[model samples]
Target: MAVHKVSLDEFEEIEYSIIAIHTPLEDYRLAYTLNLILELNLSRSAKDILIDIKEGKSFFSKYTFYDCKKDITWHLIQNKNEVTQRNNKKKATLFFDQNLEIPAQTYLLPELKKADFFLKIEACHNNFNVTKTVAKMNTIATINMVYSVKTETIKSKNNLIF
Candidate 1:
């Protein structure tokens, strides 16, 4: 896996080079890959970080903030279609495969601004609050300091669950 580091404005953006892997296939390590990328990019502390996942659909199974102590904000953009927001303080992780059994907490709205896809995921006590909307070929999810908090874990993992 190759890593590309670039700084934009006051935010730091990191793009991980990954081989395109189609969905519904085993041996998919997108979760682990994302974890590694986050770890590498997070080495330098910053107020905000943007991770652009434009390569392809990534399957992330775990996301932990054990080493992160700062109140960092993460903006995750996927395929320039979907986006997920998360605070560094809240230990966040994701787990899912082709057969997505987890229900979508947020759906993309059409009234909002047009984008590929944006989905915001804010880690709370137990569950994560999700907000999503779709426009054109994009889906958008936004989360700020004001969003309802839910109580659910992505993979039933102990690291993220309190």
Candidate 2:
């Protein structure tokens, strides 16, 4: 419930009931800030972390998560690009487009909320199965990450696709 502005130096010793990180910098600053938070030994006591990166201009801390054993929730509102498979394409290619950064933002929230240790990983592939697998390994509790895919939108009728 408590929110505060934290600098790189202050992050190491911050003792707030709930830490809310709103960093506008990207990459180095973001990595340093997140690293500071993860390195802290207050995972068991912290709760409800809100990170705002909507205005972030750099991509420094794009793939890192805090390591804490608290009920943490992140409210990330940003726009980013994703790589998806193209229909009828034989080779792997990435198409860059602007889209809501929901997958990366909410991917680990549930696990972090129930975990005592922070689980930091790179990109959360746009697959619910991958998210669930990572969550299972990180949290102590049983939580499910599910999403529904429309059958009509799928180009391939392969049932073994995972």
State the lDDT of candidate 2 residue by residue for 1-162, as single tens digits.
999887788654311111112223433443344344334222221233223333322221123234344423221211222223223424434865444432232212222232212222222232224345333323322222212223344342231111
Q: Give the TM-score of candidate 1.
A: 0.18
Off by over 4 Å in 1: 1-28, 40-67, 72-162
The number of the candidate with the highest lDDT is 2
Candidate 2, residue 45: Cα displacement in angstroms equals 28
- Residue lDDT tens for model 1, 35-105: 35334231212322232233323232222232244333232322212334332244334853233222222
Q: Each candidate's lDDT (Cα)? A: 0.26, 0.29
- For all predictions, the C-alpha RMSD in Å is 20.7, 20.4
